[model samples]
Target: MWFSALSALWLAATAWAAVDRGEDGNIRSIALRTHTLKQPYLDSDMSSRWYDFGGDTVIRTDSYIRLSSDRPSQNGWLFSRVPLTATNWEIEVEFKISGKNQLYGDGFAMWLTKERGQLGPVFGHTNNFEGLGIFVDTYKNNRPGTVFPYVMAMVGDGKTPYNKDNDGKETEFAGCSARGIRNANIPTKLRLTYFQDKSLKLELQYKTEDEWLLCFETNEPPTIPSVTYLGFSAETGELSDNHDIISIDAKNLYTTAGSSTPSKKTPGRGGASKLAKQKEGGSWTWFFFKIIFFILAIGGGYVGWTAYRTNQKRSHRF
Candidate 1:
């Protein structure tokens, strides 16, 4: 019995120690390949198994995906063919926006919507979308006193149209000004993290290398549905800029397996509320303690087994 218990504890401890951890000892989240996009973006057949790029979008096998060039009246987009079913996930996008003209109008958007491959008025994509839209607006339209290059988030209920006239002021709920996002020398990046019916956060990496600045994080985020497609779109008007997406990497948070996600919620009649839940604050102290206790159990079992063997030998001699 002692030997069996010690053997089991030793195996359990070995498995626990083998988990992947960073130099800082933090556990890395699992990557979801279905939603992740990176180099060698397309297959040899000149097509992606997971994505579809359309309109003015040009795929450069050697480098980035040019969503829209520095020309007027250009609109382009890239969308994932399958829905991102992960309930808690983080998506990081590396991109660049550059133009020759001193004045640049229009901008790009990142979307998680129920529908995909639709072209409409809102940021060159379809209006009345059923999920989240993160608009990176470079041009200042209306709303005096606010800064340009604003990053705003809006949740649509599939009925309300985006307020394009004044730059979506009516529908936007959370946002912040990101002035240095355009024309950056270093690699510019944006990270969007969402927990379904929970929190949502956006971070920017435009100023320096590997330094992420929080654009927005909310505990009471607008309710986002569990199933949604990931997509990116950009538009260029009279004043144009080159909207290039270098890469996209998406990862799942919490437990790796998608089976642990919360059940999908049916959308309300014509509105998505602003009462999202936040991930419960906790720590892994108990997990660490469990490993420690198992190690101690193994040691105790070995000691007991040795004593039992000695007693049996002495008894046999007597």
Candidate 2:
């Protein structure tokens, strides 16, 4: 019986050791949230400090970033300066496309690449139409007169043309059904998750006041192992539309064969200190285990005393 109890304890310890706790520990840095287009750009107005491109190409209106098109190849982008070296991570954002008379352009994209700083919409769409364009295509292109906007991901290394005449061979990643939500009607949330084991997952949910629905999902994984930078981008040609990005939060996990560590980066938001507080909540499990050990110790002591009493009575009788 004692041997079995010892074996159970050893198994429990082994199981506990295998659990992943990458998000624990102190944070390295936390940036104050700021709108990408705040006037005067005061430190207090900074909610999410975005790496804004096009200067006045974007505006904060009605609780989102509005990217407008005033030129032939107008583009807007915001990215964190942090390096995402972790093997596994999650990136999510809330986006809404509004306004009318928008045509012939790629929508918004969340990208992870080694290239530093901003790469404009020309680098985004290959041959002026395709490259790595995770396009929330608002206007009809391949399918004409379709009210449903399609979600597509375009990918290529470069070797492509830069004109509408060339339909570049950029790989299309995912798409959504465009029946329910109109282009200017409702907001949607898009989430992309990369696992350490080379599995990439994508999910899109329609935003609501209470909850979001998992409208689309995919199991296709990323070919690359490590991505240096992560950010969002949008482009408009003749027809103009705006993508209002509400929030973006990411949790990066550093893992090897033996150990794992998690670091979180939330752009334009604050929550790192709260995560530290939650780490303390995990200690209750250890306390519960200690209590169980104490109870077992007391029970063993009682059993030993009972055995001693029995031996003493037998000896006395003899």
Candidate 3:
């Protein structure tokens, strides 16, 4: 009996240790190809959605989403309903600059936010550009001295705007150079990773069939809450510019604990809430299992030592 209990404890510890650290957190993704968008509608995969501020938009190739900013006040937004909580996650997409003009305003961005559903060029105009936005800037209006083809991760609430010209303290997260990914011609892949422990990393890469070249990396971390919806948007003012999204993939890194176990709660209108509760319960179960295993290991070790001592005593008497 003791041996069996010890073996079970050892197996339990091993199983817990073998749990994949980088599991995709059971995140579900949506593809943008199946859904069609009207001119003013948002483009979305089944998992996430997008919205445009009124303009001529069309689905060109089955995989590519296109927008035309003929109207001066045109803007586009693709947002997800997921709330921003403190968790680890990642968002990646492919973007290309289709057409260009003199004042193309701001091109587009990958946003993780909790802003009230008003979408437009939140970077140049207002203080509500809060949360985080990875901006691909075509127009150098914000940074007059700099040339085109730049990327930046904008953080902080939409209440403060980062001044591109000033070095210190105009905005929260400032712009960075993405000279490698900007081709004005070809497409490039952008990826952002957020750790629940307040660590954020950004990577811009050029993708080819055989390999991916990493363009830019940042030492700074993302300054947003844990759980937030991941999405994209674009805006244009005077100078006409259009940004196209080829694809998007997002994964939630934080999984609720004990998700595998069944719950006793009566399922009702609060299905989502109940599901969340079950996840929390699963986490507790995992924790409890770990504690039990530890206790068993200690007890088994003591018993084994006692048996060894008893055997030694018998041999000495003989």
Per-residue lDDT for 1-318 in model 1, tens only?
Answer: 666766886787687666643211332467788878887789889899999989899888779998889999989999999999886778999999888889996899999999887877677799989999999999988978789899999998999998877888988888989888899879999998776666788999989989999888876678777789999999988888999889999887764332233333457821232122111112354666676688778778789899999999999999
**Cα TM-score of candidate 3:** 0.55
Q: Using lDDT, give the best candidate's number.
A: 1
Candidate 3, 153-269: lDDT as tens digits: 667665666564432125536455555343434557776666544456666665353244443344446557555555566666666566667766655455435333121235574
Put down candidate 2 lDDT per residue, 86-149, tens digits, no spaces: 5566666767766554344445566565543455654232232222344565545455443546
Q: lDDT value for candidate 1?
A: 0.81
- Kindly indicate the candidate among 1 and 3 with the higher lDDT: 1
The clash numbers for all candidates, in the given order, read 0, 16, 23
lDDT per model, in order?
A: 0.81, 0.52, 0.56
Estimate the Cα RMSD of every predicted model relative to the unseen true structure: 8.0, 12.5, 14.5
Candidate 2 lDDT score at position 191 = 64
**Runs in model 2 with CA error above 4 Å?**
1-52, 59-62, 69-73, 101-106, 116-133, 143-148, 160-170, 179-187, 207-220, 253-318
lDDT of 2: 0.52
